[model samples]
Target: MKILHLLRLGAFVAADKRLERKEIDLRKLEKEYEEEDDMELEDLDMWDERKPKQGMDTRKLDGRDHITTWSEAKKGQQLGMYVNTVPGLSEVELKNLFDLWQMNMINCCNFELTFLPLEEERMLVLLPDGKHLKDFGTMLRQDKNCLTFVVENTHMLCGGHPEWDPKRPGKNVEAMEKWDQYHKDKKIEDTKKKVEGWKESIPVENKDEL
Candidate 1:
């Protein structure tokens, strides 16, 4: 029993260290995301080199062949099954980061978080931005999910040699662009519909006059 406990503790420690490293990467990502507008789209420097799997092509993935699997896997992580626990940031904020990292389209779905454990028992806090993060205290009060561990098969995201999928694109600015385009298109479509409605409301001869 003691041996099992020690092994579990060790794994947790390793995971914590990994999370810490990812935090540094996150900061770098944030900086790039902040400055992306000034950058040229053709620049390959925008890609995160760490994404490609071991023994795979060392170059940036300029093609779409490997990106799909990586994208779906990340989406799975963002919308994890059964439970979701975010430490400092609210659940939505963290998931938003994941989505942005993937450069995926905005997925505005109602997240029905079922529970928030005691502060100490909650997940470790990694990224905390008092200025940027929104208050989700109401979510905590309303949450109701059961707490449990989830095992993930991450090998798919970063495939080995013969297999391949680079890491998350780490291009949030690009992702935000997707949202911008979606909203822009929706606005245009809505305006068209509104004009059609107005035309219907007014008589055909009146439409020609005013």
Candidate 2:
């Protein structure tokens, strides 16, 4: 009877210990979730502080806000991304840079980014010419989806052989001009056809009504 009593006590102790362990694990999980929520809230506040006000044309390019993605690194790191220039710079300057950049690197989506080996962790902007970009730099690490520029301080600016997409055209000033002219002609033709349709649709007022 004493042995059976001891065995029952042992089983009760084991069950109580397991319950205590499960409670501790649940508390740890809850704490982790709370920490994550706090981090997200901090991020939102930081973004609010850094973000520019609406209607700031200079801050925006081609009706889109200057897209800046933050680094997910434990320590702060440079960040960069590729984007097509829908309407970049003044029309003349845009064309000039486009031509120059195309000559150097095969044009992808209007522009390709290149990083420089800057010893200092300050921002490095990739421009068509060696001119400095105001607030941009290379991110130390990136996810697989991103296209990156291999930085070399010795090489010239915009030095990148980015991944290729066959559908885009290379540097062709004549072709662009032709394309612009074609669009203009099409617009004029479309307007003329609309006007003719309107004229035909208009019922002639009876002479008696006049």
Candidate 3:
């Protein structure tokens, strides 16, 4: 009993240490996020000539038309990477997790996530380049909790966000359905395998006894 108590205490201490380390990491990431928020990433002096914006007249058009001005988009031409956080994470918690992921991926690729006001759960990651997408994918697999994926074909997104169309399904909506189906199928397959194993484990005489 004494040995068991000592082992339990040791496990608690180890868990506490892990929690402390995670808290410290979060604090550091928060500080970095604050600093990065202040610094706007502008065109570097070393960059060569880029495409100029095509000007168009918009004297009296509806704001809903979307193409209001000739001004360039804030996030230049970058690859749109999407992550569906459909697991009931709050806005703040999701942002902190994304910030932590960004911190983990230092020196690989520089990018930031944009969460739409309407679609808060889906994160729009604007990757500046495609060189590190695979690297990020490898790291993503290590994080069993992270749902990092690119949904294709089933539903469409407008401007890196899902549009609520009465006619068509939204992006992650279809993706989530597919995910559920995948898990359901896997469960059935696993159950079958377990049944086979159990059948093989029974004695040969017992197999006939039923």
Candidate 4:
């Protein structure tokens, strides 16, 4: 009977040791998990730091460095307008009429005229101010030589320059491709890290079961 008691005590001591070792292992795992969480937070902070701040301009990110928003004209200058000529008017006739009209109109003294090479029926007129542009539009609506006109302010009209032709390929295509590849590589790296961490978290004894 004494031998049996000694054997039982030995079993209990072995069980106790196993329990203590398991507890120690659990504590180590918890510490490692906390450390991984801290590392993830630091990575997130670093990524956030690389992003554009709120209300910050992001034109450079998208390769729109050549584009600029239209700003208000200064006191003495004015934004330009596109004028459409009468459908039947020849280029020479339109030019002659524009020259005569511009020379005669006292309000257009401070204005400048530019002829775009696109179409003979179209020209750009730069008036002195908003008030002058309004008056010019009113006069143009009454004139027989004019068809229609538009103020060149919006993105569609302003961006229709020959340099920004839609038929041409975008200048930033390669940059965009690089940006996409960068994101893909980062995603792959993150996935690999997650898989490795999951593998490390599994116990060696339980690996055979998986």
Best-performing candidate as measured by lDDT: 4
Q: What value of lDDT does candidate 2 attain over all alpha carbons?
A: 0.36
lDDT of prediction 3: 0.49
Tens-digit per-residue lDDT, 1-210, candidate 2: 434544665577678865553434444444455465554443432224433322323422322111221111211222332322322245454445435544444333343445432322122434442211222222111112122222322111121214222233121234446789999999999999987787777678633343
By TM-score, the better pick of 1 and 4 is 4
What lDDT score goes with residue 162 in model 1? 21
The global C-alpha lDDT for each of the candidates, from Candidate 1 onward, is 0.36, 0.36, 0.49, 0.51
- Model 2 residue runs over 4 Å out of place are 1-169, 206-210
Model 1 lowest lDDT segment of ten:
126-135
Q: Count the backbone clashes (under 3 Å) in each candidate.
A: 8, 1, 0, 0
What C-alpha lDDT, on a 0 to 100 scale, does residue 153 get in candidate 3?
A: 27
Off by over 4 Å in 1: 1-171
- Give every collision pair in model 4: none
lDDT of 1 by residue, 1-210 (tens): 434544665577688855553434445554465455454433323243433322323253334322333333332122221122333456565455334422321232223232333343233221111111111211221232212221231211111112121343222223446779999999999999999998899987798875
TM-score of each: 0.22, 0.21, 0.34, 0.33
In model 1, what is the error at residue 202, expressed in angstroms?
Answer: 0.9
TM-score of 1: 0.22
Candidate 4 achieves a global lDDT of: 0.51
* Winner by lDDT between candidate 4 and candidate 3: 4
